[model samples]
Target: MTTTPAATPPGWYPAPDGSGTSWWWDGGQWVQPPQVPAAANPTTLARLALATQILLVAGGAVAATTIAVEGYGVGVASDYLNGNDTSIALFDLYDQGTLVGSIAAIVATIATAVLWAVWQFHAAKHVAGQTRRTPGWHAGSWFIPIVCWWFPYQNISDLWRAIGRVRPTWQIAWWVLWLAGSAVSQLSSRVYLAAEDLEQLRISMWLSIVGELLTLAAVPLACLIVRGITQGIVQRAATPAHTLVA
Candidate 1:
């Protein structure tokens, strides 16, 4: 007696015999097999973050240099305007130099803003694996005009909340450092701008120097915070699934 061939699976193709060729399964009907794309390498996100941070740092440095030159130029200009003969000649040279410095500073500020935005975007994308939702909104909130001026503090608060969600007792030393540094920097800028006498200028300059030092300290602290957060995320992601045994 002759035996009948087994039926081919619904989604699969049949053998090339008069039997049946393997069927290509399409969405509706059998078609060619689909190719699956390879997953992205996780290290790409870290590298992107590093590159962004470097760009931001470089941009900030350029901007700082420009601001310093501008301050020096303006100081010389003020002295000349106040009737200092020596300062008059110095002002001429600084006037030209300051024009160039101002342009460079503007470019650097723009570069820093762009790099920071990219950095925040990549960070939000990468951190999504750890948190249930994206934190991009927090980054965007910083650019909202009148609201943006005060939002830095709120952003820090929200960031702390986000961190608390991931791990209890996440030290807020960096946040405090950054906030204090920023406040001091702003105060220094205002003081420098409002200085009337030579004594006031001297005091403002010292304050500005202190503020800058605080800012320098805050940068490393911020870096450390980012590193800690990333490590925490990786650890959380690497946790193995638990099996229930009877």
Candidate 2:
């Protein structure tokens, strides 16, 4: 005797390998129909997104404070050029805080990605008729080189349009700031690490300051976007799984 998988409503979902075929979900398993990957609870995704942003913001603040304590603007580099021991201590503290923050951010990001990918696939299934993009592309685009940047945005756009909104304002703002902060922050860190003189170090410090400010501005927007999307999904989930099926 075999345990029958508990039944779910019938729908068309992505092929398990994400290879672009529509499989039928037989109100149970992926027999003749396709199946969406398992997703985390909506509340869980929202909470994780919020927590990750908080950790990143706090880490960024700690980093900025360390720079401020050393002083900002011109000639500060020469001021510390004598190699004060206190400066070294400050760096040690900053390093520790940064390490913890980085770890948290990384873990949270992976979870968020997986959660969104699954949700997108499920949402696509509810669309009447054929979806513009394949369900596999919903999650797979993020991992593809170069195309990841724009493809993820495309996938997101398709997901929300299915829900009757044309992508919220908060999402656009969040993505822009996120990409900007990442670029400037990476550049600043590289400059700081490669500084060969007091002047170079000073420039790098200012860049770091700029990077922090960008990320700081981005945090709340990110939270709002996450909340909006997660809530939207939860509300949609309340209806029959394929209410919009053609």
Candidate 3:
């Protein structure tokens, strides 16, 4: 006599061939075996992150160029105020240069910010789907003006935490480099503001230049970090449930 296996639990699939292969139950009847989920690929995610980084770096460089141009303008204005005719001509040259540079810089900054925001939003969406946690407020903090400059640091920290939750092996070196670069930039600005004379101004300019350079360096590092995080997420997603340790 032939016998049938007992009914499977609610919302569960029946094993194929009575061999106990788990299948999804459609609440009415048994269906085909569930398809294996796709695994995340680190290389692809890294490439995307790198693309975002490139955009960010390009934007930052443009902005910095404009800032340097503006600095030259300040020097020229100083000379003009001092009533030196030759200095006035030089200052005029700088004013024109700064105006052009400022326009370019603003354009680049907006473009880069938009790209970065898009990439971050995409990443957050993927993460939220995987973890079932809403990324609402955390993602919105980047657009809040004065608070954005520093508060975004906290947002980044939280992002890193979420990344770690998904993939414990993810590295965070890029975040550190970005933070260090920001500190240097802030210090340079403060030093420039404290300068009293032309000689001091010159010195302060050099410091500012160094700070800009550091920021430029950090841009790439930050990109790498983003790439790493993306890769980690992809890798985790790709990992098989059986292979993953609880």
Candidate 4:
């Protein structure tokens, strides 16, 4: 009779998923792995995140102002439709603000979106060993169609929990507001594009205003999340694996 092979001792091994991170193999089962210090520092990416958030806030303010000016244009359009004399100069000013502000906001949003993905990619490295998700998920999740809504939020939550902390309320608040705002903004854009009269346009502008405000409120929470996670990563980098409570 052949003897049975000896059982493997408990230890860390390369993750089965091939995520380039390790997993803890307890004698009989796979369990939570110890924290691995990140090879790269996240401090630089954190600074970039802060700058992008500020740019987004400024862009949002400009967009809100533009929408307000456009709302005023609804009155101008109404008066012109009623055969009343409209101030051409004021209408021109509104047009200029709308065109310029919209462009600025679009540029800022595109820049922030691209850089935000980069930031997440780098930040995820800190928790690569702890999170079940691949590091790429942090950045890719934001671009995948319908899943983008929930996946990015989950990725962020995972990153947070990976650091041995409970999900914060601000994170929830930020995601909810971000989702609602995006939906409302899209709805407003469609309504505005389809508007046949001043009343419809006014409703659209109201929707846009609401969406912009909600997004603005979420900006600070997003920044806080960035700051919190960045600090956590730094702290984890310093704390030895044996000393970690989790």
Candidate 5:
């Protein structure tokens, strides 16, 4: 003899439309569906955002310290070139510190970038319905060509506005500092690497100093941006989908 399928039993099940509504099944037939509030847990995204900003601030400090160490090397080299007494041991120590600091800063920066991208990816997902930009764009935009500069900002600005319908003015200063600092830092590093004499080395060191300062200035702005966006997302997550701002 053939057996029949068991009944699903009387219960509420999510609607097939994915609109966050629930339909009741009364043993044998479906009942009218009602709207149910959709829930979102974005604590992980908030934590990731906070971690990324911490790394960013720490990376800035590391970069600034590295620049300072290199500046000291310039002074030591200048003294030795000018016939003043400068110990070779001291110069060697400065060189070692600069090298180590540079490596640490590079590593920290890479880690921070990765964490930041991950955070943005998840954050964008929370507002997927409200945005034209895809979640992938949130992270991938940073690695794109010329668009990297503009797209990342646009994606983030969209996220900010989509959540609370408020314009993020702080992003302006944050983006400017990030772009300028990156350009200046790259240029200064190239100049420093190409220096062939004490005068050239000193000038390059000064440029590096300026670049590091710009980067340092951007750190706080970055922290603020991350915190604001993350907080907005977390707050939105606690609200019912039906009550959310469009």
Candidate 6:
């Protein structure tokens, strides 16, 4: 009688093709993960992630400011409807928010792209160590159809294990919140843009506020993961192999 291969353990597994890059086994083998390319130094990737986190914080603050401005405008409208002399123009508050928010949004977008690149590259490098991965595959995996999600997740998982780091409970929570936030933000932006009245616009803004809150909650967790991974690898590099083996 023959027996099946035991389910892969929850850790980084060698690539089926003998490629230096590896896949993360999430207590199961649901799909094959793709590879990344040669990349920047791991520290550089960590720094890039840090920079992105800063930009994200600024973006979150700007988003909160817009929410406050919108909230105040609603009060002004209530004042106007009460038949008082309309002393303040709510449009001015909206305009201010639009200006600052737009700039912050642009910065956040660029920062996010940089963060993603660094993460993928670092993962590739972590897996291959001295040999490393090809530069093209690491940077281009996200754009590949159907492979993007699995590839990145596996890379990050492999990276955590390669560095001997533990996956925190908050890690999964952050991802759930991050995905939820992104989805809501997109839907909210569409609603806000298509709104024909102040009430509709305010409702959309509130929805956006909720999304931003979720994203903000996730950002710090992400930063923690980046820091932990980098620090772990640095220690591993400094420690002699004999000591680790003993």
In lDDT terms, which candidate is top? Answer: 5
Every model's TM-score: 0.53, 0.57, 0.55, 0.74, 0.77, 0.67
Error of 5 at 228 (Å): 0.7
- Tell me the tens digit of each residue's lDDT in model 5 across 1-246: 111123777666664445566655555444553343342468788779878888988888897787778778777877877787654457778868877987897899889888988998888888888776898988999988998989998888888887885766777888888898888878877887898866776777677777778788889888877888888888876443342111
Worst 10 residues of 5 by lDDT: 237-246
Q: Model 3, residue 101: what's the lDDT?
A: 64
Report the C-alpha lDDT of model 1 over 174-242, residue by residue, as the tens digit: 456555665776786688679886556546655655655555555555555445544543443333223
Model 4 lDDT tens row, 104-193: 778877887887887777788767777767888888889899989898998888888987788897688999988998889889889989
All candidates: CA RMSD in angstroms? Answer: 11.0, 10.9, 9.5, 10.7, 9.2, 12.6
The Cα RMSD of model 4 versus the native structure comes to 10.7
Give the clash count for each candidate.
9, 5, 7, 0, 0, 7
Q: Report, for every candidate in turn, its global Cα lDDT versus the true structure.
A: 0.52, 0.59, 0.58, 0.73, 0.76, 0.62
Candidate 3 lDDT score at position 153: 60
Which portions of model 5 miss their true places by more than 4 Å? Answer: 1-39, 81-89, 241-246
**Cand. 2 Cα-lDDT:** 0.59
Task: Indicate the TM-score of model 1.
Answer: 0.53
Once model 4 is optimally superposed onto the true structure by TM-score, how far is the C-alpha of residue 34 displaced, in angstroms? 15
Model 3 scores a C-alpha lDDT of 0.58
User: What is the C-alpha local distance difference test score of candidate 4?
Assistant: 0.73
Off by over 4 Å in 4: 1-38, 74-89, 240-246
How much is 157 displaced in model 1, in angstroms?
A: 6.5
Clashing pairs in 3: 12-25, 13-23, 13-24, 15-21, 39-238, 40-234, 40-238
lDDT of 1: 0.52
> Which tens-of-lDDT digit does each residue in 48-95 have in candidate 2?
545555654555465455345424333334445676534543555545
